[model samples]
Target: MSVPATPMERSVPRDARTSTARMLMICAWLSLAIVVVLSLSIGATGITLAALPDAIQHWLAGSDDDATAARHSLVLLEIRLPRTLLGLFVGAALAVAGAMMQGLFRNPLADPGLIGVSSGAALAAVATIALGNEFAAPWIGTFGPYALPISAFFGGVITTWMLVAVAGRHGQLMIGTLLLAGIAIGALAGAMSGLIAYVSDDRELRDLTLWTLGSLSGASWPKVIAVTPFAILIAFAIPRLIRGLNGFLLGEAEAFHLGINVEATKKFVVVTTAACVGAAVAVAGVIGFIGIVVPHFVRLIAGPDHRIVLPASALVGGTLMVFADILARMLVRPAELPIGIVMAAIGAPVFLHLVLKRGIGGVE
Candidate 1:
């Protein structure tokens, strides 16, 4: 007879894990810096690198009175700043949510959008619009600014909770079952959204349709401010989940044996995912595949550890969205294409390649 190893003995390999963690941190920081610089530099109105900092300073100081200074400030602060920051926050939030969903389900292809959260949020938003109450309610209209994002966030939370309750049992999420349930829920939401669209006036219908396609063109300071708190809160919460996510890789029973509270971890993962994805959808509509694409690429470079994977996904996701936004702005020049279309255009082919190269089950 042989004695079982102690919990500490069965833990992740320390030396290799530490090395991987360091590499991921380096890559994440570098990528984040590059994206920020690139986002600030490029836009519809040209702003040279040398003048960028001055524009930012003038905007911050509320002293941009000169024509050149005012134009640059408008470009940086009003247009590029909100859009880029929203993209950064939305991208980071979606990627982290995707990372958590993958870890929770132990399925590499899992994404919050695919699981009906985005659709759910979109449905709710479209419903609000159809009701002619996009900003008419006293509390929301009084605030005047935060109404859309606030409504969208609540829509995401409610839909995600419904999905979880419908799909889960005693805190256990069965991957195949969950996917099927998500498909069903998404279809239902999509159908209802269509029904709402059919009965609505042309203008409302068009607005709702455009909203579903996703665009950062609507980016504004208020939306950026609205998404910031939830995004930061969720992103901050993700690091604390590193250990539990790592535990998930070793199988549920093994994780439980290692002192992980599996049920609580699952619940936390679900709530965090909903919160993050909901905020993104509220702000950006349904920009797809950032969640699915970014985490896999991060794992390919940084390995499968959640600690590294989560942060690296955020960095990579932000960069990808910023670039995609650039392309969206430029692709139709003077007429913006939806960011969702741009992401799907890029993401679909790459996703197919990853699927073929790794096979469905092989991605993990």
Candidate 2:
């Protein structure tokens, strides 16, 4: 259970001052735009930022006569653009999903990963990699290139549904019950994934290992399309859930007393989070820290206003992911490091500092 904030804290307008929120929003937008441009312009190929307009023009105008322009266009259009877009969508999805989960649970640490979604997705992906020729043959045959992503998406959805079922009492969903059930389910899913990994051949092991570590190296236009709808779903949800999430900070009973449809809010959050995290995991593998770290960081900057935190988290998260992807490409030169590793290296110390300095008193 979350510790309730004091009366003085609750009395703050919108749970954040307007000036701070506005400034954060401005900074977030600028940061995102800058990082996105950099992500497209910088890579192992040494593409200069100034040349992007020409490259884009060449690509759009279908001019292959200039070999230099053609190469730049190919790199920009086919590779970096899709990869950058994937980072944006995946990052935004995870961050907003994290913010929503934290608000719903009234816990500062809450994220999609807390509820077994990532674990379930990882388990399914690993299983597909390890057992596709055997147990998953039919689905693999049908899905072909799409089999792993499909498995991951459904795996997350199924796990959340099971969590909901186990945590429901009478007609109401208990936050405490849901949290406990999620932890148990997440642990179980992790164990199952480990078991599958244990029995896999060397080739299967390599594939699953890399998949779990996470990357945008496999990013393409299809993946960008696949994850975009879920990102839009999360965007649409933020406005509707803002009031409920704010009221939730006062506790479920208080939210109910405030005329918020607590049950409906809970269900919507669960469904949206499942889809968002599922699509993100399906495309980028299990990139961690963005969900937990981005929202918390946003709250620190913008205050606890869901109005500020949600959208700001989306911007900051997307910025961070694109920046991280750039680092992943450049840090090891031609051989890329897993983006997940880069995220952990960047996020862990920051999270530890926040916890130590602020104490975990549940998002006040």
Candidate 3:
């Protein structure tokens, strides 16, 4: 026979858990800072942190009078900084997106790719690569570097809209229908993307291959700027959904009774998640597992509270990406491995461990 817990016993654990969660939140932010610095410092060119200050000062001085300093500064300002920032943004967006999806679906294993968003983005990106010279020329001319990302973003958006349309009944979103529809649509999108890749010329095929594997080699100031708004959009929207998300953990009916607009919250989550994942995929290609792994790790340290889980996931996600990018650059030295490959190698093992130890419903 089991003994019942006293109120004091329960209250003490709650206080201790809250304290531990807060401490982990701070630790997450600090880890992000450390990784950002490391990302800016360690690379093929090997810009030491000690020289980073001097490099920045020279880069801002607007004169290449000192050839050595100019080279270091150029590498620092032009290459590493933008790449670091992109990692942070993409990491945060993808991880937070995973957190939101997990909360919405009430499943610890959920990810944005479950709903065809990544597939749609990939299909559109691949299509642009194959057909850019003919069909996408006008878009290329008009948008310049923005064209591919823009296409991918819209592809994700259209996929989400379709998911909503197919899964909604009487103004209520059915989770069972959504999951089934997502799997079917996602498979279709993947098939189409494969078909496009199969017929592409050598150059386009190479580009498609590199992109589908994912890389930050194309990181630039414009790409960073493009993804910033979406990152900010996710950040701004998270606080409003915190209560609803926490209530959602108790089931949709309980959330509705707590005065949460269950339907509205569902719509908001799907929209924001799509936009976040879309923009991340747009700039960085199809980097995976940051979404799934980061949130689960955060929950392990910080507990399952969305208040801590969401923001902490963003911080930890960005940190993980920056670190992964570092390894990608250093592992092969000059030739650079794709960031996605590094992520998969690292994330797959961790995810497997989590599953074995905690099981699927272990977020609590």
TM-scores for all candidates: the values are 0.86, 0.93, 0.94
Greater-TM-score candidate between 1 and 3: 3
lDDT of 1 by residue, 207-292 (tens): 78678988888888988877777877876787788999999888778789999988788778878888888889888888888998
lDDT of 3 by residue, 1-364 (tens): 8766877776987889888988988898898889988888888876677777788788788787888888888788888999999999989999999999999999887889888898899888998889987987988899887889999999899999999999999999998788789888999999999999888989998889878878888999989988888988987988988998999999999999999999999999999999998898899889889888999988887688999888888889889998999999999999999999999999999989988887743655
Using TM-score as the measure, name the better of candidate 2 and candidate 3.
3
After aligning candidate 2 to the native by TM-score, how far in Å is the CA of 187 from where it should be?
0.7
In the range 1-364, model 2's lDDT, one tens digit per residue, is 9876887787677544777888888998999889988898898888766777888889789967988888888788889999999999889999999999999988888988998989998888988989889987889999898999999999899898898899988878888989899989999999999999999999999888888989999988888888878877977999999999999999999999999999999999999999999889999899999999999988877678898888898899999999999999999998999999999999999899988997653444
User: What TM-score would candidate 2 get against the native?
Assistant: 0.93
lDDT measured at residue 41 in model 3 versus the true structure, 0 to 100: 80
Question: Candidate 2 regions off by >4 Å?
Answer: 1-16, 361-364
lDDT of 3 at 245: 93
lDDT of each: 0.81, 0.89, 0.88
Q: Give me candidate 1's TM-score against the actual structure.
A: 0.86
Between which residue pairs do clashes occur in model 1? none
> What stretches of model 3 exceed 4 Å from their correct place?
1-10, 361-364
